[model samples]
Structures are given as structure tokens and as C-alpha cells.
Target chain A: MHVSAILTVIGRDRPGLTQALADVVAETGGNWGDSQLARLGGHYVGSVLVELPAGGLPALEQALRCLPDDLTVTLVEVTPEPHPPEGSRFSVSLVGQDRQGILREVTSVLAEMGVNIESLETGLEHEAWTGQKLFRADVQIFVPASLPLEVVADALEHISGEIMVDINLSEALR
Target chain B: MHVSAILTVIGRDRPGLTQALADVVAETGGNWGDSQLARLGGHYVGSVLVELPAGGLPALEQALRCLPDDLTVTLVEVTPEPHPPEGSRFSVSLVGQDRQGILREVTSVLAEMGVNIESLETGLEHEAWTGQKLFRADVQIFVPASLPLEVVADALEHISGEIMVDINLSEALR
Candidate 1:
């Protein structure tokens, strides 16, 4: 058994920030897993999944030593699901004029259907020709294998009209 | 000075393979850095960036001991460029029916212009209406701060017609 953690750090961007945290993970004999690290608004922001030997070690807390005092750090321990859910992965992509609550509205629909969002990325880009700021979101969703695909398709089709965006839903077969 | 090593491991897919290698990284007091891991054709394949102490233990190469004998592993040491190239990051996204040499053609154009590719990811996705297999590639390129963006844009425009694909070039301002 191993301990799984999602370690997040947000601070000024620099080259060695991840290395500093990774060194701490190593010193504790932990396995650093997949991560998404990016820069936002002149700040370095990232979340990493790390696996550690179950229990013991104030060492991770000591990771504070490696970072500057002002950074915001959050470490959350993830408990493995008693029974990992059975599902199929699908992709949801959105593009349209930037607006408030687009995410909330779209996700509320998914929530109603009992779908699980696996990963979500939202960004803003200029629309070609129009030069308007366009909001785009790409999401990977987990639909219970027992759920009918056509049902989700129908639901997504219904919501696109309400959300006023070009949304596409498709199976992301691995 | 820290050691940056790109370590690659490929074997039959299993859950604990990365853990085994990561344990070794921890034991050697190395820093585990950014990586991309994926399953391709029933194989567990991954490459990890690990920072090691300058020249000492044969530990990494001996990682062979922890993995099954059939697996293939390779380690490449990246020598920091004497003068790391100065640049602005732009994105190149491609979408079209599957074809050979699309990557070759696109990258060759960038190569001619002395543009450096920072990161690239390629995958097969399906076209919505046609239900045809579509090839997609997203690339982050570093255009030397000295290189005019229009020059690259003009070059990309010239090649898109020849390549028979829809390619979009945009600044991915961070």
C-alpha cells in the first residue's frame, strides 16, 4: 500500500521550484507521478501527484524549507476509492465568446447525469478574423460504462444550444 | 550544478513499474522532474527527467535489475546548450486525414527557418462529420526573439496548401 498525494504550489515562476519539491519527495522515498505545471498571470502554478510509503515522515512538511515563505502550498492526501469506478473516457470541447458561468452551466449538466470529469482545461484565445476574445474549454469526462452513450450525446446536444457555444462530444478511445 | 538526465523505460504494462524506478531515483538522492508517460500497443512506456548528483553511482543504469529483463531502457544526458536559445513560444496545431510525412513537411519548414521546437504531442482523433480517422498534432515552438513572427506565419501559409492540411499558428502567450 502507498500513500497518494496531490501537491500544489503557486508562487513566482522560476526554473528550480519543481526540482526543490521533487528533491523532498525523493528524500522521503516517495514516487512522483504525473503532473500538470503551468504559468498563470506571472505566477508559477502546478499540481503534482506523488506516491509515498504509507505513513510517517514530517519530511514533506519540511518541504517548506525549500520554498520561499510567501508561496501558497497545499498538500491533499487522496484516498483510493474502495472500488474504482468502471467507466469510458470521452472528450468535451467548447469554443465561443467569453462569458461568465459557461463552466458552471456546462458542468451542472454533467453533474446531473452522474458523469465524472477526469481532467479539464480552459483557455482564452483570439477568434480568427473576428479578433474577439474566445473562451475554449477541453475536458476529459468519465461516463459510467453502464450509461448509454446516446443519452450523453443527446444531453450534450441539448445543452450546446442553451450555452451558446460550439460543443463537441466524442469518445476518446485509448 | 544539478544533473539533468532523461531516463526512458519501456516494458509490458503494469502498475508498479514507475514506482520501482522512482524508488531508485529517491535512493540516489536525485530530483525527479517533468515527464510524459503513456501506454502504446499494450506496452508500458515512459520517459522521466531526473536530476542526479554529478558523476558517481552506476545506480541508474542498474535500474535494469528492478524491471523485467524483457524491458528496454535507455538514458540520455542532456548537455545544457552553451547559450540557450532566446525565443517567443508559439503554437502550431494540425488537423487532417492521416498521412505520412505531414510532420516531416511541417517541421522541415520550421527547420529551414531556424525555429526550435520546444514540445510536441501527436495523436489520432476522429473527424466529427466524416467519421474518418484524423491526425492531430499540437506543437509548442520557440521562435528566436530575433525572428519576425510574420516570417514564420508567411512560411506556414505557403506550406499548408502543399501539405493538404489545416494548420493554425498562434502565439501561446504565457
Candidate 2:
């Protein structure tokens, strides 16, 4: 039976970084799945999903350990993901002036509500007209079946007016 | 005055792909802005926004020309991106069974209505139960002020029920 594992790697954004990782996967008889790799802060950061025979797990790790210097790798075997309670998905957006603790404040709210974040992408840019730094994020989340959609909406409504940001919350389409 | 240009590159996913580009930018006195770099189909695909002194534009392009082969690059100067008509930003998602031309059909509607796509990310996965292929995408877009949000909604409404896909559209928070 094939097992899956999550592998994350960080290194200088140089040529052959991905290929070196891919080589490990290939040599281990692993199949690389969906991966999100990008350059952040001038370094290469990536997480890959790989499936392989159970025995290949240790070999993959051993090979990763021998990869040349200056690279960091983390591998977590998914002994089968802990399937969350059946829940609804949510798509939320937050945009506002750049300030400290915005992510902390917002994520705190979601955590308080027992929501799980699935994916989040954020960016900071200068507003064209005023040159004010703008912070924006798009997040996809999962709300456990116990939470009501209206409850989430109420929570957002309560916080949106108090913050310096505009928040959009919706039951993301399935 | 500093001007901005968009640089896109595609090449084998190896070490130094991004650094090579950064080298050119640095050699020409260009400041790299935001860039999205990812691996797709076993190759590196990326687009970068860069700001550089007006004089550095030609030199930047010239240095790019001297780069080794196997890398394809496209540079476009944004004489200030044609300010789109006053409009709103939209976050749209389409998810359903994997099928050919799903992007074509959905993008056709947006294009026909003159909506400009800002960024799009998509993925395909296999359903755990039925082994069916699931396709999903998230798109960020700009709609000209001329188009009403409802018009876009209506267009989506018209298509959602006809296809095997479920779509979610919201005026992205800004």
C-alpha cells in the first residue's frame, strides 16, 4: 500500500533546488503530488505532498539528510490525516492599512470560533493614491459542523466595525 | 524616476532559477517587487514585479539577454498599467468534477464581460470515496466600474446551474 507524507524544504532560491528534492523523491520510488513552491524573502520555500511505498519513507528521509549543506527539510508521515468533523468551508478576506498584529487578531477570532484554516495567501502593498501601506489576505477555512454560519457572520460583524479593516465572510462554494 | 515592469520566466525547475533572475535585477539596479514562483508540470513558472530606475530598464533587459539558455523570459514595461475603469475587485471560486475546458468556459464568461483577472490558482485532486477527479480554482479579478456586481452575479447564476460546477463569487474585501 502507498502512504503519503508531507515534505517541506527551504533553501536559497537557486537553480536545482527543486530538482535536487525531486531527485530524492524519484530515487525513493515516490510520486510527487501537489506542491506549493514560491520565493519568499529571497529564499525558496516549498511544501510537497509525496506518496510512496511504506519502506521508501525511511530511505527518503535518509537521502534528504545527505542533501548538500544550507538546506532545511521536514518530513511528516501522514498516518492518515485526522479527518475533521464534517464541516462547511468559508472564504474570508481581510484588507486594511498595514499594522502590527492584524493577522494575530483575526486568526484569534477564527480560533476562538473553532474554525480551521485551510489555506491563506497574503500581500502588503502601497495604496496607489495615498501611499498608505495596504495589507490584504485571502483565506479558505473550515468550520466544524457545530458552528452555525450566522454565528460566524455575527462574529465578523462585531469585529469589522471595531477594526481598521474591511472584512468579507462567506460560505465558500463547495 | 523609477518604473515598474513585469517579468515572467519559465525553465526547468533547478537551483538558481530565481537567483539567476535576481542577479540580473541586481546587476541593473532593479528592486525586485512581489513575485509568484511555482512549479507546474515539472518546470519553474514565475512572474515578478520589479521597480527600477528608468535608465536601468534597457540594461535589465540586456542582462536578461545574456543569461544562459533553457530559460524563457518575457518583460513588459507597465507605463503605469492602463488604469482600469473605476471598478471593484472580485474573488471567485469554481469547484467541481475535473473536465476539459472548465477554465476556458469560465474565463470566456469573464472575458466576454471584460473582467480582468488579477491572479488565479487552481488544483486537481482525486475524490477519496469515488476516486473521481475534483478540480478547483480561486481567482482574483478586477471588474470595470461599468459592470454591476449583480451583472457578474447574474452571469454566474446563469452558468452555475447549467454546469456540474459550483461557483462562489463575492466582491472581494478591499
**Model-by-model DockQ, in order:** 0.03, 0.03
- Please report the candidate that would top lDDT against the real structure: 2
Model 2: residues >4 Å from true position, as ranges? B1-174
Measured with C-alpha atoms, the lDDT of residue B79 in candidate 2 is 49
- Of the true interface contacts, each candidate retains a share of 0.00, 0.01
lDDT per residue for candidate 2 within A1-174, as digits (tens), equals 987776766564443555567667777877655555555444455556677886778999999999976676766665543333688888888888865446556766776777765555566789999999887867667787888988888887777777778999977765
Give the TM-scores of the predictions, in the order they appear. 0.51, 0.53
* Candidate 2 docking classification: incorrect
Interface RMSD of each: 15.1, 13.9
Instruction: Please give, for residues B1-174, the per-residue lDDT of candidate 2 as tens digits.
Output: 888776666565543455567667766877655555554444455556677887778888889998877676766665433333677788898888865445556766776787765545567789999999887777667788888888888887777777769999987765
Per-residue lDDT value at B58 in model 2: 89
| TM-score, model 1, chain B versus true chain B | 0.88
